[model samples]
Target: MNLARRALLEAGKLLVVLWLVSVLVFLALRLTPGDPAVLLLGPQAGRPDAAETLAQLRIEMGLDQPWIVQYGIWLGAMLTGDFGESARSGVSVTTLIVDALPPTLWLIALAVVISVPVSILAGTWAAYRGRGWFPNMVRFTSTMGVAIPAVWLGLVLIIVFAVNLSWFPSGGYVAPTEDPVGFLRHMVLPVATLSVFLSGILTRFVFAEATDVFRQDYMRTALAMGLPTRRRVFAYAARNAVLPMITIVGVQIGALIGGAVLVEAVFGLGGLGQLLLSSVLNRDYLVVQSAVLLTTVAVLLIGYVADIVYRLVDPRIAR
Candidate 1:
């Protein structure tokens, strides 16, 4: 019952957040300098008929209405699965998002797969090995991970792996459907770029939590009871350490989305981040709004799943 109530509350909160995000996205675009109408009309913007053209464009795009009315119209159409047309391309905004989503999703998935296990093992080893060169190395790596900018790291990797060694493609993504081997080859550099940074952050979280868990009375009791060293450490200490890690993972979801923007730019991947960047630059309001909302929805869904995962990991959380 408590879990159900919590889920209900979370759902309600998510809805409220999404609504607020939509409002903010609308206003942010509208409040920015430069008129979308003027940008749309381009070279004709300074002609004798420019004002008339702008007025017609505003009316056609429903931008002549009050902000509230415009938002209402947008929200209503969005509810019906209409994200509106792209101001720049005349293409459907939804179609653009759909096309760009896959590469970003794949990049994120690869990052998680590589980062989580590597961090957990490295952190656990550092915690158990107790005051040694290995632990110092782990700590140093984590510090550097936090310090280095992802874009700089990405550029360096491209220089070494792609430019110098020719071990992987420099940039640009290949669809897995087109050629599986080529897809993996293309993904290697970007995925590794994302994983290294995320793993560095995750390592610190895991090490801290595992160290704390190792100090707890339950872990001490397990040790005293002569439970096999590995079993006791993992089954008891590691399981407890996971609760905090779940929260870290949830937070990382947002970071991954943001990081993907830079990573995509570096690698020339045609993902949602790239699309969002271009749309925002072009002042394509519909595409920008749709992309941001879609990304936010993805973040919220990950958070909701994290909540459920927390309950599963420790049933006491459900209470």
Candidate 2:
């Protein structure tokens, strides 16, 4: 019953937040300098009939409508699962997003799979090792990972693995349905770049939490109770330490989505991030608004899932 109520409350809150986000995205794009009509009409923008053409274009695009009315219309359409069409291409925003969503989801999933275990193991080892050369090395590498930009890391990976080694494709994507091997080859570098960044962030949190959990009185008692070394560490310390990581894992989805924008630009992948980037650059308001709103909702949904998982992991959260 409590879970059901909580879910209902969260759904309502999400709707309210999404409404506010749509309003902000709509207003921000409109308030930006340079008229979309002028850009769309380009060479003919300076013609004598330009003002009349612009007015007509605005009317066609519903830009001439008051902001509140425009928003109300958009909200109504969105509630019916319509996101309208791209200003430049006239392609449906929903269609564009549907086409591009797969790659970004794959990128994020692959990166998380590679990073999470490595981070947990490395963090656990460092916490257990206490004062050791290996821990120092891990810390140094994590520092570099956190400090390095994803784009720069991507370029370096491309140069080393794609250019020098000639092991993987430098840019461009192949759909897995067409060529699975080629898809994996193309994705390897981008996944590695994102994983390094995510691992760095997760490792630090895991290390801190594991270290603190290790020092708890229960851990000390376990150490003194003749428990097997692996059981004492993994079953007790590691488990408790990992609960904190669930929140970070959820938050990392948003970070990775943002990073995927630059990473996609670097790799030339036709992901949603790339679509969003191009839509924003071209001032495709319907596409931009839909993309940003969807991304925001995805991030929020991931966060809500994380909270639910945390509640499951730590019963105290339910109370």
Candidate 3:
């Protein structure tokens, strides 16, 4: 298939996945035990007219409507970019999400920037070493990196770096505009925590790819031709190995968004993960639904982009 046709097909898949996600998120929240109206009117529930107030509030919030009707109303509003207001704070869900999104984006962007090159270099070096102590150590470290919990890693970093050495702050976010140095300091541990996890995962894949590339006939020919060590390993071998790594990186980015929840919580960053968690706990249905749907859209789009890049890099993929 041509690029245009492939893109159109991928776009269709994205739409279908998003629709399914919307349905699942909507139903899942409603199926949960607590009633939003009751949660919203917690203290007032003991009043004599509490039942009457709850009934009125439910009607106003459209909770009295059938599931299909509620879904229809929400879908319609969503199409027009109206995510509705939060049940607890009465703030626009869109506004709340927009506010929380930047910190998470910064965390992900920084982690990617730091991790990708580091992983590629480490993996290529490991593969080049070819069964030495260094390669064995890299493999062992990657395994432990993948096995370690991000939350636990975050706490350990806090104790060693933040508490003991006083090199970085333990938690809380500061906007770069307010104080760039402080912002970097606050983010160092969280970013490092996320970067370590992602690097661990990416390095393994890179090592596998690079190892295969090194074994290729062309790579052997380059070595026989007395190609410079750097040029042979990087320009020839690493370049070929990195094409498949694009898709791997894209998938990791999506996973990174989810993983940020734990890292953000540990560090107290007011990111989307924290917002989604709080909304769910408070039974803020609209916020929860919108956050989940938005996150699904991001992940699906990232995967779609990765597929496109993969096809572009190796046109034979379209076959």
- Predictions in order: lDDT: 0.89, 0.90, 0.91
Per lDDT, the best of the predicted structures is: 3
**For model 2, what is the alpha-carbon lDDT of residue 146?**
84
Model 1, C-alpha of 28: deviation from truth (Å): 0.8
Candidate 1's residue-wise lDDT over 41-147, tens digit each? 99999998789889999898888999999999999988999898998989989889999998999999999999998888888878877699999999999879877
- The TM-score that candidate 1 achieves is 0.95
Using Cα atoms with residue i matched to residue i, what is each candidate's TM-score against the true structure?
0.95, 0.95, 0.97
Candidate 3 residues 248-305, lDDT tens each? Answer: 8888877898899989999999999999989889989999999999888888888889
Clashes of 3: 0
What is the C-alpha lDDT profile of model 2 across 45-78, one tens digit per residue? 9999789989999999898989889888988888
Please give the ranking of all candidate structures by TM-score, highest first, separated by commas. 3, 1, 2
Off by over 4 Å in 2: 1-5
Better of 1 and 3 by lDDT: 3
lDDT of 1 at 179: 94
Off by over 4 Å in 1: none
In model 1, what is the error at residue 106, expressed in angstroms? 0.3
Off by over 4 Å in 3: none
> How displaced is residue 233 in candidate 3, in Å?
0.5
